[model samples]
Target chain A: MIEIKSLVKCFGPTRAVDGLTASFSNGIIGLVGQNGAGKSTLLRLIAGVYHPDEGEVLVDGIPANDAAAKAKVFFLSDDPYTPKGADVEGTLDFYLGLFDIDVDNYHRIIKAFGLPTKRAVATFSKGMKRQVFIALALAMKAEHLLLDEAFDGLDPLIIDAIKSEIISAAEHGKTVVISSHNIFALQRLVDRFVIVSKGHVAREGNNEDIGTEFVKFQAVFSSPINEENIASLGFRVISFRKVGSVHHVVLLGNNESIEAVQKAFNPVFIEHVPLDPQEIVALEMMLAKKDQKGGEEDA
Target chain B: MLKHYISWQIRKWWPMLLIFSIILTVTALYTNAFTTMAVRYYDNGSEYVPYYSFGSTTSNMPSLFIVGLVLSLVMSLFVFSYRTRRQSVDVFYQAAYAPTTIKRVRLLIGLAILLLSMLIAFLLGTTVFLLRYVSTPAEEIKNNIKFVRISVHWGMYFLSFFLTFIFVGLHYLINCFLVSLGDYTFDQICLLIFGNIFLALCFTSPVIYFDAALMKHGVLNDYMWYPALYSLGPVGPVALVTTTMEQAIFQRDVAGDFAVNAVVSSSIYALGGIGALAFNLFVPDPSGEHADQAGARNQAVAMIPHGAAAVLGMLMAALGLINDVSVLALSILPIFGFILFSVVYYALLALWRHSFRMKKFDLICYVSVVGGTLVMLTFAMAL
Candidate 1:
């Protein structure tokens, strides 16, 4: 288990990770965030690559910065480090000195992925490089795996293979935290989702919990209603779109709030719309942006 | 773990070691051979006696000193370069081992490589000299006189060996400290070059200025300034090496004095080495997040040497003006000197900060250094 408590990290004047608090246990958790949303910074912080300016990160009851704690965690960055002129064998030797890796599994994964053992990883394609690091991360058998953009350049076939491997690893009690912008890839892979925005966890839960927390409603009101009126009706509207007098609204509330919105609008016709994983994440990001703008205005 | 890391590092850096070894060996051989061939014989009445002088040998091999210095710097830079890249930083810093252990192991391995290469060259050079000595024909000398008068001075050999290691070690430590001051490799390289030049100037300029001042006051003459000028800073060790070589070749019983001087110089540099080591091991490692962000951190500390150099440079200029111009011209010299210092200081500050627009901190540091230089110049004029 990895625990982050009020973590804050800054670069110059920009706060990359600000008071972010989250916990991950033995399961695959998807970290979804937009560009420059601090996903990479958060991973580096947990990986002990960057010292936190505030708060602390605990891995398995030990401070993350401790060597003992770091030993149990393997952080595979987006652009993994491959030494110059280092072939696969040389790279493996380098990492083997640092960690006690499973040689058998490493070779097996390399063979399965059809990666050349004699060629330098720097010469490999982007997808191939990602595979090499993923194989190594899996072979490390660390208790916690932090992967940033693990599936960015991978083809669909390799994605399925890696997803299956991640599932198997999680089943064996390894806590895997993967940060990627590809929500679709993570939809079927992760058991839980963490939506990050402005360096904090804007929303976090399993699919079922997130599904219940956010509701999408399509309604045709008797009169034209602006977002202000809908918000005035006491529903926390995340997104509102109008098409030919038909309203499509995503709200952050429970079923009672959904019913209250319906009663207030007095729609000619109304239907509940279920949100997919991508839509859910998008709505959460939109809500975070709105809150940020509101806070700036208030300040 | 340290053993494995050492092995890995050595394997990675063996090519560099081999190259330096070859260069040092060739230079050593050429130096020894040239000195041996330069040996001349004089016919003194009945016997042809060999006249030996090794001062020319040390003097002829400036390349040896340069090789050692460059090897130390290049190796130190290469070894610590992992800290400058985000990817490598992640790999090494996130490893299970403590960073201190990693850094220490690297330092040890780098020093080991440097010393090993020098040892090879030294042994080979000594062997060649001995072989040449033994291979010299006795029949060529009339009246059974020795063809070469000098025997191998084992004491000097050992002293040279000790000084070589100490010199290279201190150079490595200082280079490592300077390399760690910048977040980017380019900035680190600049700091390494600028820092060394600045330090050399810092040591040598004051000596020159004071020597000139003393000469002007009639307290010292040109002949007396040589001892004081050559016996300090980087020059002191070089002078020590040459003097020791000369003493060794003459078979003089000055080993006691030589040992004292060697110890004193090494002790002073060793203090610097200790401070560098402490700074490297104690200061917080630069963040990978700031990798490539030049002048992001340590800006003030990094600028210190350059600032001091600027002040010393201005003083040197003033001293030059005092000698070349009349009292009337000297009165207005500080203003001209200050303007020149400001222009150069601003340009260097731009390079250091990587921007033309100076921050308030930069302005403050600049003003302080220029103001300090002005005050020092006034003090010198009053004196």
Candidate 2:
């Protein structure tokens, strides 16, 4: 288990991270935030690279800063910290030396990442570099591992490779924390998400909760659809478009409303358009903004 | 693999190594030419060398040799540092865990090679000094040996070579300060020169002043004050000498070689080393949020305040020429200012600029500041 207690980091007058408090118990956890939302800062604080200006971090009920606490946690960075001018062999030697990592495990993970074990990671492409870091995290096999922007810039195959590794790590009972803007990608891997906006944890629950409670419906009709009829169907009117005989309507709500609209509209073509991950991300951000506004109004 | 890391360091230095070798060869030839000229000149009626004087009240060769030594030493430091810092900090330090004793051993071995290079350079510097003012072609074997013996100890630059390592190593350790100015290449040169000049001035100022302390101790005690020069290991007050700020934190009575107690001043260099260690030991975990890269604050700052950066640089150089006591200590003063400026102003500008979109000129501003600071400190201290 890992815990963040009111963690804060400030850059000049602006806060990069603000009063973040959360805990993860044995599972795959997803952290999501927009650019500059302090997601990486939170991860770095946990990794012990940057000390929090306020509050503390704990590992398994012990101070995270302690030597004993650090041994169980491994943090993989968004951008791999490859030794400059170091070839692949030199980098492996370095990590193996620092972590006292076993050669068999290291090589196995290296092979798993599909990187030539002998080539310098510096020479590898950005995606390949991320793979190397992921490989190291898996090999460390620590009780807890943290990763930032774990999916950005990765090809689909590499992403799947990493996704599988996360699954495997979780299967082995090691807690994992991953952050990404790609909600759908995250939805597939993370059991739950901690949505960060304006430097605070705005939401916490399973992806299913967000998926089921907040849904998007798309219906196409051969006949022209009137706005009044769409309104009569009783679904929030997100948007509508017409192309010759085909009329399209998009709605957001629960399954019952969607089913009722499906029966009443009697559309020729009905499609449950999976909500864009970014759109859901935007919706969550709106919730955060609303929360802030509510707090301001109260104050 | 650790061996590869060390070799990479050495390879980075290869060009500068070649430069140092060339300088060493030239100095050696000069040393040989001058010493031979000194011997040959006295046997002839007139001197064979350009500036021949036998028993002058004030000597010229010591000054020349000191300048040559300082020049060569500073140059080698430049080469060593450029090669060392070219790699990102993460890569080099990642190798620290390579093996027990590997890091320290590599450092000591690197130091040895540097020491040998300095020794070769100093020998040539000595011969250059020896031939500067010769009388006849051959002054006789015994006469030349005696002359060489009296002034030749300055040729023992190897003694102070340890000091060079301490200073250069501290430069590597305190890369934060180096990175702050935002100009890695010029910033490093600035760092090496500023540090070397500060210590060199501290150690040599008293000698140039012919201060009362040295007058009372005589030339020999003056040598004692210079632990590196006297072949004395820093063990007590003698040990007060250091290359970094760490010594001052502990209040060690470091023996200052030139002006102030060298031991005390070396503490400033030690301070830098400790800072470097602290930074690496407490690396932050970014946890894969993925939008971040290592702080390129300098790159960000390079956009604003190019001229003020220039002035601050000028001020740093001015501090360099002050007496050894001041030079050794004051060299870092600008460093503190640079860090403070970066910490304070970077944030202000960052917030104001908030998604601070940077242009090329903005980046140039910081590079100028970094490069200019180094040049400023170097010449300013000379004054």
Candidate 3:
């Protein structure tokens, strides 16, 4: 179990991770955010790569920066470090010297992934490099695995293989926290989603709850209704658009708000649209942006 | 864990170490052979007889001092290079060992390599010298030689070797400390060069200024500068070694006075090395966040050379005034020096921030440096 409490990290004037609080225990948690949304910063903070300017991170009841805690966690960065002129065997020896890894599993994964043990990792393709590091992370058998951009350049086949490996690791009681922009891939792998925006958790829950919270609707109205009317009708609008007098809106309220939207619009036809995991995350990000703009105006 | 780390480092760095050792051995052999040939001469006694004068074994090992200095610097820079890159830092600093342990192991291994290389050269040079000279007929050479003064005994050889090791150790320790203050390889190299020169100037400039003041009073003697030159920061040990070697070459009794001087200077340098070691181990590792961000890791340490140069500039201005230079020249000298130092300072700051547009903090630091320099100038002029 890794627990982050009120973590705040800053790079000069820019606050990268601002008061972010989250916990992971024995399951795959997907960290979904846009570019520069502090997901990488948060992962580094938990990995103890960067000391937090404020707050603390604990892994299995020990401070994350502690060597004992670090031993239990393996952080595979987006661009993992392989020393110059290091072949697969050399790289493995380097990591194996530092951490206790399952040698059998490491060799098995290397063979399964078809990574040449004698070839320099620097000569490998982008996906191959990612596989090398992912294999090492899995072989480490650490209690917590923090992977940044875990599936960035992987092909569909390798992605499925890695996804299955992550699932097996999670099933064995390893807490896996992955930060990636591949929401579609994440939807299949992760048991929970933590949507991040502006360095904080905008929304976090299991897949079922996260998907149901932001309800999407397509409606046709007799009279034109702006976004303000929808909000006034008590449907917390995430996004509202009009195409040829047909209203399409995503709202973040309960079933009552759905009814209120139907009653207020008195639509000629209204239909509830189911949001996929990607659509839910997009709506959450849109809502976050709106709130940010509104707060800036108020300030 | 430390054993494994040492083995890994040795494997990575053995090529460089082997090359350095080879260079040292070749140089040592050449220097010894050259000195031996230079001392062997034909004396005009009856018929021309070949005479050999082995004055000092210590002076034959100049390669130890010169090559050891190069090895010290190169090893220090490369040994701590992991601290200069984010990728390297991520790999090394995230190891399952404490940061202090990592640093300690690296320092020990660096020192081990340095000492090992020097020992190889030293032993090889000594063996060659013994084979060529010690087995020769000593009585016959002494009778034929007119200037056969072997002033440096075996004990002096031991003393010289011990002091040389201390000198090289101090150089490596201080170099490592300077390297730790930077966040990039170029910055680290700049700091190593600039920091040593600045420290050397800081120690020597005051004595030069004082000598100029005394000269103005007509109380200066040539020998009066010797005591003042005895503690020239990193340069002090070099001067001590050269002076001792000179004394030995001249057949002077170096045991009484020069040995005391060498011991005192080496002690001071040892103290300095200790301080560097303390700073190197105790400063917080900025980790991957500050890697490759020159001057961002330790602002206070980065400002040290600027601060020292500022004060040294004032002392030079004072030295000019006492030397009876024109009043106008004296006034322009410090202003010119200040501008030159400021340009260098700003250039380094630009490299650190990767921007020419100075931040408010940078401006404030510049102003503080200028203010501190002015206050020091005032105190000196008042005195």
Candidate 4:
């Protein structure tokens, strides 16, 4: 388990992580955001790579940077480093010298991934390199594994294998926090979502809760449903599209408000369109952008 | 665990270590041969090669001192570069030990390697000399033994060799200071070159000039206050070695005075090195975030206290030198000067510049104020 308390990290004038506070229990957490959204920086802070400018990150009751706290966590960076002259076996030996890793599990994961254990990791392709680091992280059996871009540069089969391993790890009560731009991939793997925007968590919940909060609907009315009438119906429209008499609307609400919209329109045909994980996140980002522009204009 | 880590580091850089060891030994042997040739023309010269000195001071001392210094610097920088490169720091320290512990272990290991290398060089040089001496005629060997019996002792030679280790320690201290300046190739280069230059000038050139001045003023005749400046150069230690040799050869007692002076000088050097190492160990690695602003703040803060002290010290010392101002007035003036400079330079310009980002005009003002303060301090010191 990890807890962040009003954590703020600054890189020169830019605040990379701004007053972020959150708690993670033992589970698989998916961190999603656009580029430059502080997702990677947040993980680095939690891993104790960069000390915070203000506030604190605690693993259990210990400070994240403490030796004891650091012992429980492992951070697999976007580009993990391999020591000089180290092939797969040598690299494994090197890490064993530093940490008490499970050798049996290490060999098992290596075989499962089909990585060439004798070849130097520097010779491996980018995807193969990621696989090597993933195997090490899993074998280490650390209480907390913070993986940046966990599924990046991986083939479909490899992705499935890695996902299964992550699931197994989480099932054993290990905490795994994964950050990636691939929303659909995360949608399949993560039990909960943390959406970051402008160095802050814009939204956070289980996938079901997120789905309930954001909905998309399609309707066909006999008569024209103009902008004013749609506004009067009072479903906060995220996006609206019309083709002839049929209108597609993306909204922020649960089933009750979506139902109210259907009753108010009295359409010839009405269907609730289930949004995929990407669409839900995209809609939220659009809303946040709109609010920012609105605030700027008012000022 | 610490021992394992140290051994791992040593093995990791074994190739470089082996190369330097061979190079250092060859240099030492060549230097010893050159010194032996130079001393052959002087019939009264001692044939007893000082275990530390190896018989020739003028020809051999600088070269031997230099071998130790270069070996220490090269190894220190090599270890520093290997351990503190941006890539290594991020990866190696990510999951492992605390950074400070790693730094300490590397420093200790590097020092040990340096000492070991010097010991090897010394032993090899001594062996070569002994092999050459064995082939000399019995009459010549007897004559050489007489010289050795009069001018050399095991204890004096041991102390001579010990100075080389002290020089290595000083080099290590400088390397630590360079590491504290953040990880940048340009900064590292500047520090290494300038640090060597500074030490060379302090030990060699400045001492000669001071010696000439003292001789002209007959200040050497007053031994009481003269020892205060023993820390100025390599003079005191070098003189100690030379005087000990003279006392042994001539059956005199200049050893007591020169030995005390050398001890004071060496103590100052050792204490300075230890202080620098402590500072390097204590100062945390700079966080990249707001690094520029943080550096500026630190510089400003450091400058104020230093500037005030420099001003005060210079004023009092200058007044003392002129021999005009009374003791009471001299002491009071420096205190007043310290407060004035601290308020003007530290409180006003440094604080203001640190508070706000500088525009073109503001930058000009900041530079002017800093330059003006420096000029004033320089003039006062010269007085």
iRMS (Å) per candidate? 1.4, 7.1, 1.7, 2.7
- Give the range where candidate 3 chain A is weakest over 10 consecutive residues by summed lDDT: A207-216
lDDT of 3 by residue, A1-299 (tens): 88889999999899989899988877999998888999988887777778999999999989888888888888888888886888888888878766778888888887888888888999999999899888889888678888999999788898988888889889988889999887877867898988888888877888777757677788998888888999887667878888887888888876677788888778898888878778887777777778878988999
Task: After superposing candidate 2 on the true structure, give the runs of residues whose Cα lies further than 4 Å from its correct spot.
Answer: A61-71, A84-86, A117-120, A215-282, A289-299, B1-383
Candidate 3 residues B2-103, lDDT tens each? 577667767766777688779888877887776643444565866766443333466755557877988889989987888787877776667767766677
List of chain B TM-scores, one per candidate = 0.77, 0.36, 0.77, 0.61
Give the TM-scores of the predictions, in the order they appear: 0.88, 0.55, 0.88, 0.76
Question: What does the lDDT read for residue B272 in candidate 3?
Answer: 76
- DockQ list for all candidates: 0.69, 0.10, 0.59, 0.35
Label model 1 with its docking quality class: medium
Clashes of 2: 75
> Between the candidate structures 1 and 4, which one is better when assessed by TM-score?
1
For residue B96, model 2's alpha carbon misses the true position, in angstroms, by 11
Write the residue-wise lDDT of candidate 2 on B61-162 in tens digits.
233233334444454344323223322222222222321133343344444554455555555555554555344333335645534322222322333434
- Which prediction has the highest DockQ against the true structure? 1
Q: What is the Cα-based TM-score of model 4?
A: 0.76
Q: What is the lDDT of residue A250 in candidate 2?
A: 50
**Model 4 regions more than 4 Å off:** A220-232, A241-247, A263-269, A284-299, B1-7, B37-54, B57-61, B82-86, B141-152, B194-265, B288-383
Better of 2 and 3 by lDDT: 3
